[model samples]
Target: MMLKDKMRQLGRRDFLRYSAAGAGALMAPGLVRPARAETAGLTMHTWSAAVDTVQSHLSAFTAETGIPVNYGNSPWAQYREGMVAKFVGGAPLDAMWVSDSWLPEWAEAGWIAPVDEFDSLMKYNAEAEDFCTQSMTYGGRQYGLTYYTDYMAFLYDEAKLKEAGFDAPPSSWDELVEQSRVMKEKGIAEYPMMLAMAQESWLIEFISTLVYSHGGRLVDDSGSAVMQDSKEGAVEALQWVVDAVDKHKIVSPACVETGELAGLKSFAAGNHAFAMVAKYRLRMLNDPAQSQIAGNVKQAMMPQGANGSHATVGWMRFHGMSTQAAQDKARAENTAKLIEWFGGKSDGAYTFQKLLFLDIGAGFGVKPLFEDPEIRAAYDSYGDVNMIQAQQALARKKDTITPWFGEWNDTNGSAWQSAILGNVDAAGAVKKSADLWNELKDSY
Candidate 1:
């Protein structure tokens, strides 16, 4: 059945439920404490990626500032849904994690308030990557301080490339296809390119990376949908994936069912010669204990398309103040201090950002952290620092981030998946996606 038809049959709510289920393997929701009394110091919420590290930092913040924190987290898959529930139920919240894509929606709903008045937080913009600062801003006002930021990156097994008689990674998508074919024919690998195209939270990032690298924009500068344009649009990008699966057979048909975490495990098992993944995964990919292909994995610029540069999509999560917390003068002040502590500096250092990078290989927004010997040495251990910096220089923020993003991403992802699965052509898929985008924009 067609994607739109299937979604209609299942209903939008059921489709989202199904999509959420696909990410369940990554993590289960953790217990979130009920909203604390107003007399309590502060309350914070985050997705369950770096719980231990965040708790440790929170502990230190409390020790130094005498501000007790009630911290909690849910799995990333359910984070947005859970946060919305909390907002509607009037749950007490002070500071919380917010994705860049959710900024317009949350701000418009009055769930999150601007932090532009906090000079302590604003001062760090001078030292942050432009992408980080820009992502944290919405509609002329800055909403939060960056918790973490990273771009999608193309990666490959250097050992596999060499074994396939190639000296370096592909610079273009066509070259990648040629390399994958040789690897498959030589029995070096089967389905040599790993892509997680599943309709989950990670789906939009993956799609955006492809679209941007292919020199296409889902939405133009004037905030209009252009993804269906015959030239320089999302069709060119989606067509590449469809061709990769159906024509070249370099990527598995099962990719539509694979989420990012599962694809990571598959690549780490040395089952694929090339993959597109989050830049931070390099740390896990090169860890001998976690990855069988350790020390062989290498980062490369995202392969370009015919009219494209090597650009890829970048995203950020920030520490945002809850509207409830911002209404109270003292609470807002304390929350800003907490935000500065975690997102900017802690005890005269980029402590949390540095710790986050060192702990899980997550990227930081702070540019000065790149110069730190400790951080430099750590990147050298698992990756090429020069290559990492070069690729980051090419990172671009997703253009489709708007108030209607959450609703449109669902349709866009499903449409792309349909094309990949051969249920629709690339033109049909992108047309469907662009149509919805335009409808959403008009309504907004």
Candidate 2:
């Protein structure tokens, strides 16, 4: 059966039981190597993204290093559960892609091994974005190198703003409401703001961006839930969103049903004057072939809240080594090379990062990449180089990531959505989220 079906059969409780049992077995001494040929080299796995580009890169790695590789991929939605099954089942694996949210759980579960001893890999941290390095590190040990990273960004339809007689995007949240009201009154747009508030994976990132930009946090450094504090940024930030949707009527009620991709499509179609979306979408929005608002789409700093700065939330996925691969010295060496080849330097430069960015508009974690003339030129074509760099410098990682994040996030997303729908007050929504966060943390 497929991994998803297996997960369904096992259920969440059973899946945790399975992972717990697997953890015990993984921790035992004398791990047997998979029954692959000694000369077969490495087995790499990834989600089915940029397949042609990844295959081309893999072919180049083999041609240059003379290392045979067996690469395979599954759909992204199924990848996490599939990887867990593989980890528990001891499938042949060397390097694989890992999302940041899974780091704590995977690390604690012994599914992935840290690469702190590898100086070649460690050297990249000096050049990487702080959060990318931080996100890869868990329990004080760095796991692997970053595959890609991006931040949520505030974007606007320039033509719509201009038609509404605005010279520039709003600098503050209140200003945004004022400008949106003007755009609405002018008939530039019925719903002048676009916010995808659906209960999905993207919801947390959206929530974090709003909270961070408003100078609020869901949790503090002690890992205690502070989202319930009205003095903190959460309540105010959420209240702004609530007012925007109900009182201002600037954001469509349909936002509760919108997913990130759908919101991107709507923004690209020029149906909304302003939007909060992933920074990478700017490339797609500016592509004439894909977007109706191409050339008229522009990026702006995340609007500030009364007490917040222009901070936004950032996230990353990385190439991590399997505990199975790390157990053997030779295999560990080869696995690190493969990871470094893709995540670090390939052919004496950040060839893969550049290629990935040029091919699909993905962001890189390395600081030097921003200085590359070609990368600069490409970004300049679709965005302001200064603004892009400026906003990225202000990005922070999500504060709620923990071993229990997956369980808590579902409740958190639902709580925020309830508030947005006016089913609960903002304070009540935050309290509900905070309660679950504290409960989960205490259990941990």
Candidate 3:
């Protein structure tokens, strides 16, 4: 949720606005190799600072395998295009971070190399494997290793909810709206809900999550944008977003411009009561250095839809080898060794779960790590209830990557914002969006 760096419609303009939210907050690397020999081997690419901070860990890999590493990073906006060009041009990068959304096209185009040979190296746990199998398997081949995962949940103020006469978070849409009403009336919070209604990638995350919650989906089994076609589900889902912003006048009008940072700050400052946010964002929300609401905030599942939306609408980022790297035997071996060490290979026991996942809120896709008794006891434990409950909640309802997502995102974003702003009706906008989605597929 922090590093949007979106490579879609509403493209580069708003891309940088939210990507760096958790930058520089990662703990210092702890690679006690004591041998810092420099070799010009292994170039890894990622846009986020969280990955950047872990560069020193390469020393540990180098110590273990004697392979010196070069860490390369680009501005989030250019990382995708830059890497795509590198892949097409055969400019070798041993390993690089790849979004789940980008894997389909890259793998289809043969830009990324299959990692089936290194399968044993990639397994941290079942969840990690599941993420890779789900995302990296583009066309009968697995091309990447998942390192980071982001998922959504509802983060609400316990004190604020209590003041509103509710001891627990709302479970359904009606309950949420009524909770907001009481919170507003009781002066617990003027706007109890803050969503990323802006036109950037934040909008995509929020829109899709809400859409999924209403039993609507953006794409069908055939990888077509079908939300516009599911009128009962999509329209109602979008109308709730509109009603929350305008008709009910519960959320601030500024929500139209608000992205993740704005919402996080607002919720942190106690200006709002609930934020439909990614579990990773708790790094900021519960940080003493970053939030006034830290320690006071608690999590709940997103308010349910009429049909009950169970999925969190997630995006899992993985690391993949360039086909260029795969062609060279020596480079390929070095790359695999480097990836196994850096991309979350455990030390038999004592997996670096907290180091990799909790510190930056993005790390090892290991389900067992999150459920680890020790891990739960040490950090994720929030009294009786642990946090893995929220993290596991992040699941996507549909594959977001398609030739049409950019257009779909652009059209869906515009239509939804228009409806929310009262310039168009939700029903009409969604109907048009569905038609446009079909047109986009044909154009492709």
Residues 83-148 of candidate 1 have per-residue lDDT tens digits of 999999998899999999899899999999999999988999999888888888788899999899
Each candidate's TM vs. the true structure? 0.89, 0.91, 0.83
Candidate 3 structure quality by residue, lDDT tens digits, 55-107: 65666667777776777788877877888787776664778888777776777
User: Looking at model 3, which ten-residue stretch has the lowest summed lDDT?
Assistant: 30-39
lDDT of 1 at 345: 91
Please list the C-alpha lDDT of all candidates, in the order they appear. Answer: 0.91, 0.92, 0.70
Candidate 1, pairs of clashing residues: none
Candidate 2 accuracy as lDDT = 0.92
Q: Which candidate is the best by TM-score?
A: 2
Per-residue lDDT for 394 in model 1?
A: 82
Single out the weakest 10-residue window by summed lDDT for candidate 1.
Answer: 30-39
Candidate 3 residue 264 C-alpha distance from true site, Å: 0.8
The C-alpha stretches of model 2 lying farther than 4 A from their native spots are: 1-39
* Pairs that clash in candidate 2: 214-308
Find the number of clashing residue pairs for candidate 1: 0
